[model samples]
Target: MSFKITDNTKVYIAGCGGMLGESVYQTFTDTKCTVKATDINLTAPWLSYADVSDYSEISKDIKSFAPDLIINLAALTDLEYCEKNQEQTWLYNALGPENIGLIANELDVPVVYISTAGIVDGKQDVYNDFDEVNPLSIYAKAKYHGEVFTQNHVRKFFVFRAGWMMGGGPGKDKKFVNKIYKQLKSGQKELFVVDDKLGTPTYTKSFAKGILEVVQSGLYGVYNQVCNGDCSRFDVAKEFVRLLGLEKDVKVTKVDSDYFKAEYFAPRPFSEKLVNLKLNARGLNVMPDWQEALEDYSKVFIEDLA
Candidate 1:
């Protein structure tokens, strides 16, 4: 599978406001691929505002841009929010990708869809590309729909399933790691984390680079794109405190999911680690370990706090 994308090749990125979308946009730009970024809320010079649910809106943009590859990175990823607002979640997560797939199919162009490892039943120790999906929440179910729709609708598509994304974006991060950092930086001396819930944390920039490698290779299918190691919320919080040189004595306590029953009522998978077998088999490198990725990511904010 040999593919070549030059500076003249146009690549359009949908959902350019989120962390993953921002990283994808930057990666393509760095690679010298002619890029056009689009999102519903166009805040940056590179972004064009368009709602993906409106077929006319997305189709018009696709037709006008005439890109060789379209990367659909827009998704409604708030698990609890999805549980509360099922209709909006499905519309944004499932229907949005369906519309993108339809447009890409009509134009006979490939689409790179960013999916999530959350689709797998977290009961399993780890999941691979071929693992059965047992989504525990509306958010995961919606993302799974996007994955299925993409595969069925488009002849050439790459579904990259990423886990607990970190890094990139401007104040858009709400993952566990970022939350821990915020709490600690706010001068909280104690933190309570669930020791049972487990998954790999992915750095957006590294994940974006892996996706580009797959695109350049022209090997299209579902692939797990995540850091090399897995950890629980407790593990991540501990690492966050350690890296910041915060007091090791800053009392970190372990609790069960039941502790936050009111705040997090949505059913969550206990573990959602995804193995990057496909990338490895193809001789393509996956992202670095979550610990290493976090260390690099902390550099951006560590100085600001100090």
Candidate 2:
């Protein structure tokens, strides 16, 4: 609750090309802050090449930036890929935070590390900041380690755990929401959605704004940054079809986990419904409801439906 993120306050981002990262960069930039965004892919011109797993490679530039705060947004987000490449996942998800935490120690800057809802086994109804984590996949385990490292090493940190992210519109969206849109766009008549799974689907822009506000305020700790409400994957797809006016055109069929075949290589928790209990209690809840966020997100890509 000590430092407040201000406009033109030098800031360095480690992963700014992804959906959430893009949202953060755009939102903070809109505030007229001195922002430098970096990514491994270098997909955009504003993004410079930086790998979070290797601190030595990026430590010099990061030090040179002299940022007031460093937000480490880098991670191996692909669950299946993480399962297949365990070592790489560990390096990026776990060691990545550790590497940046070390740098933050030297520079004495607070770090913002994005954790995942995957840390839990999904056996319960909803998870809070106080809930014990039981990661199922390699990605989840590594991310849990990332949170631990951040909490243990970093002098000051904000660990945000995001659930079922929705954003990155056309080309960048790789999550469940965009996946359904792509299938529908490809002229799939019947979309097989997993009804068994349940989680909160969050919009990236809303999360971006929430994180920025938190960064600017005195609240810093673990926060569940998902949209309000909870539902299954089937419900989300149905909403997509309804919002797209494709309910009449596209058929949303409910299916279990087995329907995915080999697509789900890593074992996932049956549910990952994270509640913003702490944020709400502290009056820091800034994200909107799931339905509202979905409507807004759909409006952004309404052309895709057409």
Least lDDT summed over 10 consecutive residues: which range in candidate 1? 168-177
TM-score of each: 0.96, 0.97
Per-residue lDDT tens digits for candidate 2, residues 1-306, read 556666758889998889888898888888787999999988688999989888898798799999988988898899999989999999999998999999998999888999999899988989998999899999999999999989987888899999999988977888998888888888899999999999999899999988887887756688988999999999999998898888998889999999895898688888999999988998888989998999989875687555
- Rate residue 32 of model 2 by lDDT: 83
lDDT of each candidate versus the true structure: 0.86, 0.88
Instruction: Report the lDDT of model 2 for residue 4.
Output: 62
The TM-score that candidate 1 achieves is 0.96
